[model samples]
Target: MALDLEGYLIDVERARGLEDIQTLILHLRDQYGVDHIVYHWVSSDGEQYGCGTYSPEWAQRYVDKDYLRVDPVVIGCFQRFHPVDWRKLDWSSKAARAFQAEARDYGVGRQGFSIPVRGPNGQFALLTVSHDCDDEAWDAFTLAHQRELILIAHYFNLKALELEHARAPEPIKSLSPREVDTLTFLAMGYSRGQVADMLSISEHTLRAYIESARFKLNAANTTHAITRAITEGLIVVGGTSRAADGGWPGRRTPS
Candidate 1:
């Protein structure tokens, strides 16, 4: 099952545009026998884009009503680093309850599981699967499907990132040696002072290195810089044998 899902993910990765993504979402919905599947992303400049199995009417209504303001999925997912179940979100608000009803009316399932993905430069995206199954069935399905969902979420995010890169005003800059060293230390759970002492630099210097790395990586902050560096293979986790000596890890050869 995992191998087959991997093949599906490879196909999804090859999708080139919004139309291709919409097709893939529909295909996955059918393959998994789910009621709906969606991929929605908000870029750094507040531009929204996505493709999914939601009805056109619902999509239009969502936009017309500006449901983005009260949608629990958007709110809850933004605050989370992991998958969220729809039931766990605060749908108790009158507006949220009305939105949920409208969503159901438009064929969005009553039950949902969403994975929130955060990318560099404040890019936020979500991959969600929704269905009308009972709680026990939904729970089991999500457990069975969690790994595949995560892979798909990452694949979707990568494609979006690629598109964003293609349309970017400036090319992303590569991290420098000192900048890489700073982020690597932070990624490995090092304190700024600890990293500075180890590198024979002052804490202020260390902060400058980190901030430079963050800017080069187009990251929103230090943590985001570390994550982007690791994801882009600019740094490797546990690849540092000299971590004990307070020395930075050897840099990866450029691919």
Candidate 2:
């Protein structure tokens, strides 16, 4: 079935609170014919929040069992800057295998796609969709909706950040010209040395500017910083970078 993506986005923007977001996720799960759709976030100060279509029993079981310690999806996705398929994550360890089995028994699907999201002020989140389906069907579904899902992931994070702002607003910091230039070049497929040379700065100076920008953006890494900068319209990429090597150069694709 074709999802009314435009309508869903409108509904998301109109969402007033976490309850609205949860309702939207439930709607998405049903509309996409998926077992579950989840949005989970952790703030820099260690606060956690989530909205999803998963059963309460299963959600409780996960916490009770401390399943995250052995959940390969969570661990793998945390280290990645792109979307991922569950099959690509390692589940070879006995503990991981046991956790997988437990999750399956709790109605978690065999197939899943997850997008990692990073927001300002050190927020980390994951937007995931899971379903019970054969490999071929799952592959087709993901291929057909990959771009939509990516857009939704970013939108979901944006909405969450908006909610945070309402709770306690913070002033945004503008990046220095050098920092902006460095990130723009990095996003455009230029090496660090290349960006430094183009900006007529030493590599050491460039690194300093980049690190400062990363701090201002509250990004976990250089790639994360570049992505946040681009998403926030702080910089524009003229070319693609090594960090975005696969299909779309500067855009991250599912692996």
Candidate 3:
């Protein structure tokens, strides 16, 4: 079945709970003619939330085995700010190969694309689509849908934040000047080392600033903190509007 992307997005935006997210992924799987579509997130405070089309048995087994510690997708995506093709991730390790084989046996697909999303307070997540298809076919599909998929990922992240806020509203914290500078450089695509040099700060000092900012923003990681800062208008980047008048709290925001 052809995916009515326009309609699907409406459904996505209308989703009211985690269960609704699961149902939407099921619909997306069928429409994309894919084996699965998944969105999984881990919050800064250690809460986990996810919705996907993978079979419950496989999902359970994965948890029971603690495969995440060795899952190449998780590891690879955590270090990246861009979308990734599964084939590009490391699979040379024996453990990874074994895991991949088992996943395939459980109906996982051979071709996949994942987008990593980082949210405030160290929250991390991945949005993924997978399919069983020849390499050429998979490539073509991704080429055609890449932009749409990216948009979907961003919407999912934003909606997830809204849901989180609804469940527990908190005060909004403003980033410190140093934190703002660090995140701005990062969002602009500067490498950590480059940023460190540009700021005339040692790498260690830079890391300290980043970690402090992450804590203040309640972010799950540096990238998440940066995203949160931008979204909340703690810092201006590239002429983007500072639409956020406020945001979530942990530390403090200047009035």
Candidate with top TM-score is 1
lDDT values of the candidates?
0.84, 0.84, 0.83
Which window of ten consecutive residues has the lowest lDDT sum in model 3? 239-248
RMSD of each: 13.3, 15.6, 14.7
Mind giving the per-residue lDDT tens digits that candidate 2 earns over 140-244? 989988899988988888998899789875544678767878898888888998988998999999999999999999899999999988775567566433234
**Predicted candidate 1 versus true structure: per-residue lDDT over 18-87, tens digit per residue:** 7788888888888889899999997556567788988889888887887888899998999787999999
Global local distance difference test of model 3: 0.83
lDDT per residue for candidate 3 within 51-152, as digits (tens), equals 898889988988788777778998898878698999999999999999999999998889889999887767788899988999999999999888888878
Cα error of candidate 1 at position 172, Å: 10
TM-score of each: 0.65, 0.64, 0.64
- 209: Cα error in model 2, Å: 29
Of 2 and 3, the candidate ranking higher by lDDT: 2
Give candidate 3's root-mean-square deviation (CA, Å): 14.7
Q: TM-score of the candidate numbered 1?
A: 0.65
1 against 3, candidate with superior TM-score:
1
- Residue 105 error for model 2, in Å? 0.6
Q: Residue 147: error of model 1 in Å? A: 1.2
Candidate 1 global Cα RMSD = 13.3
